[model samples]
Target: MEELIKRVEELEKNTQKSSRERELLLNRICELEDLVEDLTLQLKKSKKTIRTPVAPKESLAINNASKKTNAQEDEPWLFYCPKNKPYEEILRNLDFSEGYEITSSALVSEEALWTQILEKMNEEEIPKKLTALRKLVSVQLSSACHHELLIIVRGIPGNENPLFQLILPHIATLAEYVNIAWSEVENSNPELLGRIALVLECEQDLKVLSVDRGDTRLSLYVEKLL
Candidate 1:
């Protein structure tokens, strides 16, 4: 009976040892699972970090250029008639750069001239086909038949008010252009022709230009004649 009791006690110890061994094995498996999960997360992060390929410098430049092109396309008007507005004093000013043009060729009334401009805008596919009147200051309209006070005009694109782009800082340059153009309207004397401006004042948000003489300051205004 004593031996049997001793045997029973040994069996209990063996069973306890087996239970501990099983617990250890289960704990080890949980640890391995956790390690694998962590490694998988780290791997996913590394993949994300390297996912985006570095663009080449040339490619970046091209993309930027394309963006600029799109922007310019949306706005068909060209920049700084600065090159030509100065053309007034210089008689050779007739030599217009590419993409610039004299809106009216024949002697047309002011109202007619405006109509011609709109017609031109409608005819031309802006941006792709850039076209606008060349900045002509000294426009000669006096003729032998009837010098019925023929004249021309000049002004800034947008100064205090912007026609399209932000007002530029080059006021002096604009002034020079205005003075030359307005001079054609008048002489050293004050101009009878009223200064003009382009504005978005009304619901139409009309566009026009203005010129100041003496100082030759230039600015934009609104003309709702359209």
Candidate 2:
């Protein structure tokens, strides 16, 4: 009976030892699973960081495209004119540097000349004749006529002369080449002042009327009358 009881105790001890070993193995598996899950989360975070650089590059490309579009839109429209010879041809024909000065006295003479013409037409009695001068200007846009127009402007006190204001735009339209001596005329008269104001107002409607003030270079530019 003692020997049988001892054998039963030994079997119980062996069974208890097997249960403890199985429990330990399960705990180890659970810990390993937790470690694998942590590594997977870290790997996902790394991939996200790597993708971050691509977003800024795309943003930069969009900005550049927008800037180019704005630049194109901001460009100004060119003046419309009838077809004429190239600008270079005009440039080759004129000499701006010499004989450009119109003395104040000469300018006075020009003003007097217009005064006489206006008086002869009885401009006060017929104000519409003054209006007709604008039409006459359009009819005579030739080089000789352009010279006469310039002479008319040179003498008139642009600020004082209503006639100058009326005629200055037509003059600008016909000016193929222009050279003004600042020494001879620097805001000297109201008529010149009026002409300058007209130039600014009509800039959009006129071609680039380059002015060479106080310089000695004569270049031809074509002024087309439409």
Could you tell me the C-alpha RMSD of candidate 2 in Å? 41.7
The RMSD of every model to the true structure, in order and in angstroms, is 35.1, 41.7
Structural similarity to truth (TM-score) of each candidate: 0.22, 0.21
lDDT values, one for every candidate: 0.32, 0.32
Q: At residue 218, what lDDT does model 1 achieve? A: 44
Name model 1 segments beyond 4 Å from true: 49-226
Model 2 stretches with alpha carbons more than 4 Å out: 49-226
What are the per-residue Cα lDDT tens digits for candidate 2 across 33-55? 66898999998888745433332
lDDT of 1 by residue, 1-226 (tens): 9999999999999987975675465556556766898999998888746556764333101111111111223211112233233333322222222121232222133333433433433432111111112111112221100112211222323333343222222222332333344434444333234332111212222243333334343444322322
List clash counts for every candidate, in order: 11, 13
